[model samples]
Target: MLRALSLALATALTVLPEAAFAAELDGRSLSALWALPFAGILLSIALFPLLAAHTWEHHQGKIAALWGLLVLIPMGLIAGPEAALHALAHTAFLEYIPFILLLLALFTVAGGVVVRGNLHGSPVTNTVLLAIGTGLASFIGTTGASMVMIRPVLRANDDRRHNAHVFVFFIFLVSNIGGSLTPLGDPPLFLGFLRGVDFFWTTQHLWPETLFVGGLVLAVFFLLDSIIYRKEGHIRPDPTPDQPVRVTGGINFLLIAVIIGAILMSATVDLGNITLLGIEIERANALRDLIMVAVTFTSLALTPKEHRLENGFSWGPIQEVAKLFAGIFIAIIPVLAMLKAGAEGPFAPLVALVSNPDGSANNAAYFWLTGGLSSFLDNAPTYLVFFELAGGDPQKLMTTGALSLAAISAGAVFMGANSYIGNAPNFMVYAIARDGGVKMPSFFGYMLWSGAVLIPTFLIATFLFFRA
Candidate 1:
């Protein structure tokens, strides 16, 4: 499987057109029909598991491949082979590869380090666990923090009958909102960092918003959990009894530190570039990816097999993300191009939605527009699209356009809680919880939870933090 992926990537790189260098399609010339494949992929992700569970579980890869080819074949026919190859190669090399490598590294290393111990799912204990995970998120990335914390939380609450809400709130806080503080906390922020936004920019600007929103959510969760805890008045025997909490596979922590260092090194250092096939790969970023791959393997080599078994670590979640996001990254190219083209493109009216009638930037609109799309789409590229629309100038954005940038960043990071597909870790957390025998909400059911809980909180946040 790995060899096949390598071969496919290699072939695309080798055939990439030299003329395709940093070129975006002329969005004004493209039709809105171009976005259908991307929409199709998103809908398939949202619906197929509900509509055809068995088939989707068995053949998600093929379904994803079909959607990818749907975009590629039509794109090649309309735009020519060179343009198509260039777009595919560019998306694969620059976006999909790096995204997966980071996730892979985090998932592998975090999976090995099982949080071995137990505790009762008391309201205070659960809230404290969540708060710890939330704090870890900004430092390690949400995916990393989610992987490390979800299992222990699940185990801690295994005896509780109403524990589904626990994981739901876990997704709300740890998997999504907690990631708002730093670039490392979420993919959207990380994309901003790569685009010349300073590493500490988000940390400095977003800290207050992160604190306010996260604090409110945590408070609400505590009250809700207390209610749930009291209702279960009869004592039930703990399925996983309390063992003294000691972390196993401690070596993986060193690997995690290495991962963090590699990211920081890549961000701070530029060592020129090497042309592989037609794509120019940065030496620092490439080295970072290499280091991450090494961290993954080193964790696997050193961590005991029993540690993973206890954690219930499986390849299914990562494999699903890998297959599905290949389609998403490919299909989203034209959408992003149109978005980049601004008022001149087919999505002009949609673009207009985020701007005021007098043409000044509306931070509230920026929050909702970036967030509404991000709820269903991958927030990273959605962020890039809006970032480009708002003038792609890191310095200017960090200064005069700070509120607009803040809205975009906050929207992309915070409102990812609106749906399961909004972010990668959301779905992974869902799958893990479901596999562990928690009766997770169905697709629409999950949406209802988010709609009731998250949407109101977000509206309040927009008024408080993002209003112009």
Candidate 2:
């Protein structure tokens, strides 16, 4: 598989037209139909597992790749082979590779650190565990934090009769909203950092909103879990039985630190640019990806096999994520280009939604539009779109347009909880929990969960923090 992929990359690089270097793809000329492949891939992700679980399980990667080709073939016909290959190669090299590497590193490292044992799943215990995971997210990342924490929380509640709600709230706080504080917390925030937003800008400005929204969600989780607990009455005998929790594979934590350090170094240092074909990427960012790949292997090599086995770890979740998001990254190339084109593009009306009649910024529109796209599309790129729309000036945004920036940041990070595919970690968590016998909700069923809990939370947050 690795050799085949490497060969494909080589072929694309070798054949990329020199003419592709002469000009950029013009989004203003592209039709909205260009988005169909992307939308089709999303619908596949949403409907496949629900409608055709067995077939989807076997052929998801193929389905995703087909959607990718559906985009590329037409793109080659419409815009020339150079443009198509450029989009494919560029998205694969710069966007998908780096994005997947980070998720893979976090998932691998977190999986190696096994928390061995169980505790009774009381409302208080679950709440505290969720709180700790929430705090850890901004530092280790939502993916890292989710992988590390989900098992222990699941084990803590495995004995309870009615416990799916626990993981639902887990997704709410730990996977999404918890990632609002720092660039280290989520992909979108990290993108903002790379775009010149201060590493701590979100930390400073978003803390109050993160605090209020996270606190309210935490409170709601506690209350709902309490009610469920009261009704169920905790009568079920402990299945795993409570045991003394002993953490193994402590060395993986050091790898995690290395991961964090590499990311920071990439952001802080300038190591010049490396251009492959017509695409340019930072040497520091490439080095950061190399470090992440190394950390993934280092954790795997050092961690005991028993630790992973005991942790119930498998490669299925991350594999599925990588395949699905490859298609997403490819398919979304045109969609993002159109968005970047602003008023001259087909999405001009959608673009106008973020501005007032007087031509001032609309904070609420920024929040909802960014959040709404983020809920379906990947939040990282959605964040970049709105960030650029809101003037793309980090300094100005941090000051005069602070509220707009805050809304965009909050929306991108927070509303990712709106769907299973909103963030990388959400699907991974769902897969892990489901494999662990939690009877995790289906994709739309999970949306029902988010629509009930998260929508209201976001509504109140808009009223408080993002009002125009």
Top model number, lDDT: 1
Q: Which residue pairs overlap in candidate 2's backbone?
A: none
TM-score per candidate, chains pooled:
0.89, 0.86
Write candidate 1's Cα lDDT for 1-468 as tens digits: 534543453344433333332356766666676677777887887778668989998998888887787767655654467767888887777778877888788789878877878878899999999999999888777887898898889888888888898998899899999998877789888778767888788889999889988998899999999998999897578888668998788898898789878878988898999976577888998899899899889989999999989777889778987998888788788787767678887788876778888988889989998999889877886798789788778999999999999999999998898888888789889988998889999878988988888888889998898888
**How good is model 2 by TM-score?**
0.86
Which numbered prediction scores highest in TM-score against the true structure? 1
Quote the RMSD, in angstroms, for model 1.
5.1
Query: Model 2: how far is 194 from its true place, Å?
Result: 4.5
